[model samples]
Target: MAKIMALDYGLKRVGIAATDDLQIIASAIGTQPTAHIWEFLKTYLAQNQIEAVVLGDPKNLDGSATDATAPTEAFANEFRKRYPEIELHRMNEVFTSRIARQTMVSGGMKKKQRQQKGMVDQISATIILQDFLSRRSNGLF
Candidate 1:
């Protein structure tokens, strides 16, 4: 079975996560600098069977576009055009960063370790994928 991948795209980096082939577990993979995301994906996709991609969609409290919204959407569009064979999905990402931080704290990560931006990004991607998996399993997606 193919896996489902999730990405949390930030201006500086893109966090990556993926499900097991059984689509039952989501794990944080790593991160890539924004400039190297395409290169990273090219290699990753070639090495893995990814059935779909879940993209973090940023939105304001009122559902207005956040500064990152357009960029995320643009990236999603480009990804769709570049890899038309794979399915793509967008998920509301409000408070994911905050949640990621809290997760680090709860996981007993040291302050300095939790402060690392890349760690939060990877956790955020994991959260995105886990949420997607939950909703899909519940037939809400």
Candidate 2:
């Protein structure tokens, strides 16, 4: 009954999300500074049972790796090195930020709240987790 976790990696900060033990729904956990992500994960993993880690794969419209891709890949590599037992998967995250913003707007989030980049990041991570869950459940991952 371990849960699955998702990460929306960014240059300055990272968004985090996790599913329940049943893995039926994804929920935003929080955001953390990029420099402290590993430390945060270490603490989090100690208290929670995570089956795997899903990372958002950033790509350009031409389907090429974006500027953020290399850093994310490096982070994933380090993550694997740090936690060799945990599986890591990447999910396409083409427009997760835009989609998250739109969702917030449509969901009646106030302008002040919407302006919080951390909130957007958390939502984007949730979206990425949900997408990964959907694909996984459909055997399309």
Q: Per-residue CA lDDT of candidate 1, range 19-105, in tens?
A: 999999999999999999999999999999999999999999899999999999999999999999999999998999999999899
Clashing pairs for predicted structure model 1, backbone only: none
Alpha-carbon error at 106 in model 1, in Å?
0.9
Output the lDDT of residue 131, model 1.
96
Local accuracy of candidate 2 as per-residue lDDT tens digits, 1-141: 999999999999999999999999999999999989989999999999999999999999888999999999999999999999999999989999999999999999999999998999999999999999999889997
TM-scores, all models, native as reference: 0.98, 0.98
- In angstroms, the error of model 1 at 26 is 0.7
Model 2 global lDDT (CA atoms, 0 to 1): 0.96
Off by over 4 Å in 2: none
